[model samples]
Target: MSERKQRADATRNREAVLAAADALFARSESPRSVSMDEIAAAAGVGKGTLFRRFGDRTGLIQALYEARVQPLREAVESGPAPLGPSTPPLERVPALLDAMLRFKMDNRHLSMALEEAGSGSPYAAGHYTRWHSDLEEMLRQIPATATTAGFTAHALLAATRADLVEHLLGEQQMTPEQVRQGLAGHIARVLGDHGND
Candidate 1:
């Protein structure tokens, strides 16, 4: 096949793998049990193809997460009010955090699976840096927090980490609304009255 054709085929295969994995994860009560073998079979590709295309289970999970969060990332990057660049820093910070929390809650199983895959510290992930930087910049805009923005941003993001989210919903048996309200209360305390702005 020509190089262009080969590239097109590869893209199609990649999409098929991602789609199959997404479906499997979505359907499974235990996402971690949805193995590479099952994903390969569902995608109509060999197990070898899966390894070759994605390196390993962690890589595949990371890719899926990145793909899933792309929309949220775009919204935060430039989409509109609340999350967009136009919002005031205090309001934007809480909004961004609430959005992240909601994504984790909505994708609880998948998020837990990704975390269990031992992909290493989430701080090392590229997406984490983007979130941290955006949050840190916002925190810096508040004169009272200028000096601690970096630490504060990381701390805030840490609250929404997948494991913690899972623990709250799974172990603590907190309803999603309770979790949201709790986070809002925590954020309000952290940001003072400015958070509701």
Candidate 2:
């Protein structure tokens, strides 16, 4: 095969693996139960291919999680109001929290997998650091939170953690709307009116 064809095949295989892993995690009772062999078979690729491409199970899960969150990242990085960098901090803080909450709710399994991956704390994950940094920067712009931005960012993110989301949705039976409203109220209390609701 030509170089271009080889690249295309590799790309297709990678996507296929991600999709298969996503499905497996979504329906899995426990993320740990979904093995690399299952993922390889589901993707119709050789087991060696999965190892070669992703390094290991944690690496594959991280890549899949990153792929899933790419659109949200883009919106937060460059899209319009509320999520974009151009939005006012007062509005952006709540918007960012809400978006993240929704993301965790929507991708509970995958988020859980990524969070539980490896022996390190989830707070040490690259994605967590990026989100915390973004949130802290926005918080610093709001006078009310500026003094405690770092701690506030972490506290706010804790509200949207995968395990918390799963508990609210699964055990407490809170609707997505309820969780969102609760978060909005919490943020409002933190930010106050300040000419921006």
Candidate 3:
């Protein structure tokens, strides 16, 4: 095959694998139980192809998670108010947290898988670093949080962690709206009333 054809085939295979993995994770009772072999079979690709393209299970999960969050990343990077760069810090901080919480809630399985992957430390992930950096910068813009922006960012993000969300939704039996309200209230306290703005 020509180089262009080879590249096209590779891209298609990658998309198929990601899509299959996504479906498996979505339906799985536990994301960790969804094996690479299953994904390969579902994608109609060889196991060797999966290993070659993604390196390992963690890598495959990371790619799928990144692909899933790409739209949110774009919105936060350059979209409209609340999530975009132009939003005020006070408004933006809570907005960002809420968005993240919703995302974790929506993609609980995949989010949990990614968080639990590789060294079992979400902090070790590139996505975690990016979120922390963005949140820290936003917190720094506000006078109340400027001094402890880093810690504050981490604290805020902890509320949106996948495990915590799972616990709240599954164990605590809190409704999604209840969780959102709780987070809004917590953020309000943390940011002194303007957090809900």
Candidate 4:
């Protein structure tokens, strides 16, 4: 096959795998219960192909997580308003954090699986660095937070960690809206604002 055809086939196969994995994870009561074998079968690809495409389950989960959140990332990167760069640091900080929390809430099972995979530290993941760096920059723009921006960014992100999200939504039975409101309040307190903004 030509290089172009080869590339096209690879892309198709990759999408198929991701779609299958997404469906399986979404339907399973437990994301971790969805195995590589099952994903391969559902995607109509060989086990070797899955391994070659994603390295391992950890890599697959990571890719899926990234794929799932790409839309949000793009919005924050270049979209408009609350999430876009044009927004003020004071307003944008909480909005950015809220977006992250909402994503965790919406993709709880997948997020949990991704967090529990690999080194068990989502902080070490590639996407985490991008988010942390962006938030750190945003925090730095505020006079009050500029000094402790790095630490503050990490701390705020910790509030949306997968395990905590799971606990808040699962064990604590907090609705997604309630959790978002609580996070907003906490972020406001951290920012020395009343969070009503």
* lDDT score for candidate 2 against the true structure: 0.92
Worst 10 residues of 3 by lDDT: 188-197
Better of 1 and 4 by TM-score: 4
By lDDT, is 1 or 3 better?
A: 3
lDDT of 3 at 99: 95
| Superposed model 2: Cα runs more than 4 Å off | 193-197
Against the true structure, what is each candidate's TM-score?
0.87, 0.95, 0.94, 0.91
Backbone clash numbers for all candidates listed: 0, 0, 0, 0
Off by over 4 Å in 4: 2-4, 193-197
Q: Compared with the true structure, what per-residue lDDT tens digits does model 4 show for residues 1-197?
A: 89999999999999999999988987887777999999999999999999999999989998999898999999899989899999999989999999999998888878888777876566777888999999999999998888889999999999999889989888999899999999998898888942222
Summarize candidate 2's per-residue lDDT along 1-197 as a digit string, tens digits. Answer: 89999999999999999999999999999999999999999999999999999999999999998998999999999999979999998889889999999999889999999988999888888999999999999998987678788998998898898988898999999999999999899878767733343
Tens-digit lDDT string for candidate 3 (108-152): 989999888887667867999999999999999997788888998
Q: Write the per-residue lDDT of candidate 1 for residues 24-57, one digit (tens) a residue.
A: 9888877878989999999999999899999998
- Deviation in angstroms for 143 in model 2? 1.6
Between prediction 1 and prediction 2, which has the larger lDDT?
A: 2
RMSD of each: 2.8, 2.4, 2.4, 2.6
lDDT of model number 4? 0.90
